[model samples]
Target: MAYKDSSKLLPPPSANDIISVANALNTLKDVKTTWIIGKISLTPGQQKFWFEACENCQKAINVDVGWVMRCPSCKEESRVVARTRVGIAVDDGTGSINTVIFGLDAEKLIPFTTLQFWEAHTR
Candidate 1:
């Protein structure tokens, strides 16, 4: 038996190419593309913008008392918070899809504190 190197058999696509949402969904999970940003939508009945988490482990905080939320997993109480749930409506002109954006990207698009976003959206 003989071994051959086939790593460079095919050239990868350009890293900056933008692809349609529909196409991206159908392709391999590893395929990357620069999708266009469109609209921001919070799903119905989702009123909270941030979720409380354990300060040490960053796990979800299920118990809340006044200003503190305690983590069940770590058994620690901390006021640390994290973005809850959010969806960004993205389109490449060919089609549109609701993609979940988190962390810094979500903050950039929303541009509001968790409490503010919650209050604004809820009303």
Candidate 2:
């Protein structure tokens, strides 16, 4: 029996693109917080904590849920942190972007230093 060569016909994959995709995928899987490319509309109350934004983007990045303290004066409840567990690539007017799937594992990873503000906020 003669065997046919199947590998020769396939196109070569770009290593850089593969790496980028892998990194994005890994980020989607590991991160537990979901943020969008938008401005912070609400002010932090007594129980509120502000997280630093990205240096380049200047957008509200990661939020510190743990830093949030209870306020006896305002009688406000702690803000619930939301996460993006699944992500799909979306096309904005300018270019492609990532849309987060809400209410998933992404909520759990909010407070870790390893999760940068910009990285957490941006798609």
Candidate 3:
């Protein structure tokens, strides 16, 4: 007798299970905020800034500023400032949370790429 192949016959998630997972993901977003450290290189001529970042779990790591920009004329250094322009968290439909951020005028922020954010937030 031949055995049936059952590997592809897994049951779909139930509504209650889906809701539970959603609640858990929302809780993660509510309780955890990942702090990403990085340097921003400014191009004043082009009116743009490029950021290279390293993300850490805020609850697990120490805060450290990664880089500073110095004025060429005044010989003074200034901390690069970044504001959270937009933040949205939602379920990815795969039983996971997806958080997205955009810069001013909906410009894409490269440092917080989807993969990077997912990796940082998820185990």
Candidate 4:
């Protein structure tokens, strides 16, 4: 096939990278994050999908009921930010597997910030 714009074209699809749910379940460690085609299932029991992480050390703090937390990991009173943590299930023709999509990835997929998600869920 003759190509006009090669830069806009995707690399030729390879079966080596293209994986199914069956293959993912059996050989996940062997596969690289090259290609995946599946449906993202947002039906999970866990309602909350965010956590307060320390600003300095980026660790999960123990403090609750506030935005700022005294981090035990960093031994400092650092500001805590709600981080995205979405759980999703990917399903191809074969089967499905549960996966946690965290950080910026979750935020990009869900179309909402962690704070926004919490506010929306609460109401």
Could you say which candidate leads in lDDT? Answer: 4
Backbone clashes in model 2: 5
TM-score of 2: 0.20
Q: Tell me, by TM-score, which candidate is best.
A: 4
lDDT of 2 at 19: 31
The lDDT values for all models are 0.53, 0.34, 0.34, 0.68
Tell me how far candidate 2 lies from the true structure as C-alpha RMSD in angstroms. 18.4
Estimate candidate 3's alpha-carbon lDDT, on a 0 to 1 scale: 0.34
Any runs in candidate 4 off by more than 4 Å, and if so which?
A: 1-15, 29-35, 65-77, 120-123
Q: Which residue ranges in model 2 land beyond 4 Å of their true spot?
A: 1-62, 70-75, 79-82, 90-98, 105-123
Tens-digit lDDT track of model 3 for 1-123: 001111222234444433433556556657553222222333224322222222221111122234454534334554433322233334334354434333332235444543343345344
lDDT of 1 at 99: 61
lDDT of 4 by residue, 27-102 (tens): 7677533346799888579778887677666566655524676678768888876666788888887988787766
Q: By lDDT, highest first, what's the ranking?
A: 4, 1, 3, 2
Q: Candidate 4 — which pairs collide?
A: none
| Residue range 1-123, candidate 2, lDDT tens digits | 000111232234444433333344456677632232322122223221223323222223354433343333334444423323333454323334454322212334244332343355544
Worst 10-residue lDDT window, candidate 3: 1-10
User: In angstroms, how far off is 95's CA in candidate 2?
Assistant: 12
In terms of TM-score, how similar is model 4 to the real structure?
0.64
- Counted clashes in each candidate structure: 0, 5, 0, 0
TM per candidate comes to: 0.51, 0.20, 0.20, 0.64
